[model samples]
Target: MTGRFAYGLRVHGLDRVTDLMPAPPGDDLPEVTIRQHTGPRPVPEPLDRWRQVRLLADGRHLAVDRRSGTATFHGPPLTPDLLAHPYLAAPAVVVNRWTGRETFHAGTFVRHGRAFAVLGSRTAGKSSLLAALAARDVPVLADDVAVVHDGGVFAGPRCIDLRQPVPGLALPGRTAREGSRTRVSLPPVATHVPLAGWIFLSWGPGPALARLPAADALGRLAAERSWPQLPSDPAVLLTLAALPAWELTRPREWGALEATCRLVESAAEAAAGQPA
Candidate 1:
């Protein structure tokens, strides 16, 4: 059975059709194709591109596409058992012919400039921090997983993400036309930045900023990572682990903005090899 999505979504990874296309053997990587369709029927026009976002706790999402005849697993720490696991058999989205395997679990995000990412738990002020950085004209890198490759972070999709700010704070020019979820760009930014420090953030009733030891910051960031089980390249992980990380408690009313600016500036400087 071809596992196509009910929506007329012709974009890659959004529907079940493209999810199931055949791939080269021994390598479990998706040969993605973005095409257009009309109400489950393939459209002659070029397919518009879009992105699919998945938030996994413990890494467990299965996808299958019938039109292309493919199946895949999106949860973290891709394992051999992922092939036969019952949970991996069912997914939030499914296509037919495509099949691939990823040893790592990564959430998707489109790029803006250097692929910057914020790793933190829910309510940890990740989105707010990113918005603040955008306000400072740093460019929205990725609100979630900022996938990093050899030399730069990968931008695979461009989407618009508009969601609510942290509980108490209100974002300027926020619109309710769409749901609470932010609209991310579809065509991802291809620009790659040299590996920069991954910043870790925290908030509290009182305002204070402290530069955490590199080790401590890495540990904290590690805990907040999306997938801890994936067997990733040791060198890449090591480099990320060695890079500096920051932990800043939320600042008081007017102080929050200043603190955010300082933190971003510090990160930029660190990335640029300037004194912080």
Candidate 2:
């Protein structure tokens, strides 16, 4: 199977082809090709880790070694959104990492020519805040993951997600057109976002926001992905170092989301002032 998607690439020679980016401008080939391994799978190097999906990275290509399809994804009703999107999207992250890029579980939005990225674990108020920000017509650069390369931010898949829906708050999936669930969508971003800053979301009693030292921010980023030591480590560390970052503490109060957004906005403005 084969297809194309955003982010300059294609899906080539795979059994169960799903969503793909449109070829880069002029029908360029995919950044990496995927093929099923019917023979014996390659043994992992001493440091390699293979959980549900096996990720192999080398100078030639980023490979996804798998036996299951989207059907194997255990979840609620088998909606097209759950089936088609995640299968391709998740592997792409490891692929980017293999290519010496850093990917984050971030929801990124552009405002006034600058972009703000929110990063956190599940239910850390990242998605709830995404639900709120989308209400104000902020263009989301990426969701689920954001790829950082050459001082800019590129879209992952459009995922305006939350643990549970909040009343009176609308999100991406609600107004999705036919097939939107299965297909990937990003705002018409003709160019990458000049990433202004990243906000690390954490939960606690106090909602105070604070600046993160470069070293501390770098540590948090590496810790989140459990990034293994490899030749690619320097590039990943350099990418995180180039950006300004902050830790946005979510107040335990249920009503604090709005205030947190305000704080995030301020942090973004402060980031905009820095050199990219």
Candidate 3:
């Protein structure tokens, strides 16, 4: 599988690696390929001070650098561990440090229906909610950090290394799994959910279910943008803004899982009706 494919990542707008980036020995670093592409890719930038993540734009910007280890495309086969470390550790600024280029960050899900994902701030119950859903027979997308593209999200072919298990949720017993920041599958599960709805959870006095206008939701979404401090791309901004969003004020208890699921499902169904 290593040399099976020709290209590495298709960052919608950057040049594919025409040549490899040299890594020195004793440098203990691996070889990297600077794939090149053509399109409107985000230019490389410094890591965000607050989140410690960076965004890079080659073609379709998307990379999450966690500062764990140097990322080299020239080294071993690509795995999900490298991807989740930087973002899950600190989701604030995802693409910047990761790809050193612009990449997409949004709530990606299954197309017709099979898998789903929940993303937001830390302690936003992403893992907990996923666990709950999994109990109900839903396969977990990439837990904290998801690799999204073409309106779909893929689960890393690796076990997500969630530092500690959630208080009450139980995970499946594993026979063999690799570790990174989040233990995940190296190849990742291809089962994907379509870009249904982007739900944002907030802790406040808001109702259990309150749908905010896209305009109003935009402000909060912007605030929680993976890389808020960095300049935003109009294309990306519009892409996210255009995505239907629902703000779930943190519920008093986790009992609202069904209600929450209903709300998201309804919204997704409605979005499907609108003209694309």
Which window of 10 residues has the lowest lDDT sum in candidate 1? 96-105
Better of 2 and 3 by lDDT: 2
Q: What is the C-alpha lDDT of each candidate?
A: 0.40, 0.56, 0.41
Shift of residue 192 alpha carbon in model 3, Å: 6.3
| Model 2 ranges off by over 4 Å | 1-3, 6-8, 11-24, 27-80, 172-187, 226-231, 252-254, 274-276
| Predicted structure with the largest lDDT when compared to the true one | 2
Which residues of candidate 3, in runs, are more than 4 Å off? Answer: 1-111, 114-117, 146-170, 173-188, 191-193, 204-207, 229-231, 269-276
List, residue by residue over 1-276, the lDDT tens digit for candidate 2. Answer: 345443333444332422233334544323544333333344333433332333333111123432221112222233344423444445565555555566666778886787777888866766667767766566776556667776777754445544456546544444222333212233455336777777888888667798888888887777555234433566657666667888888775657767776776667766666332
Candidate 1 C-alpha lDDT tens digits along 125-194: 6655655555555555444444454545533222223455433333443222234454322222333344
lDDT score of residue 78 within candidate 1: 45
Model 1: lDDT of residue 15: 37
TM-score of each: 0.54, 0.70, 0.53
lDDT order, best first, reads: 2, 3, 1
lDDT of 3 by residue, 86-138 (tens): 32223322433244322223333332353333457666666555544444444
Which 10 residues in a row give candidate 3 its minimum summed lDDT?
1-10
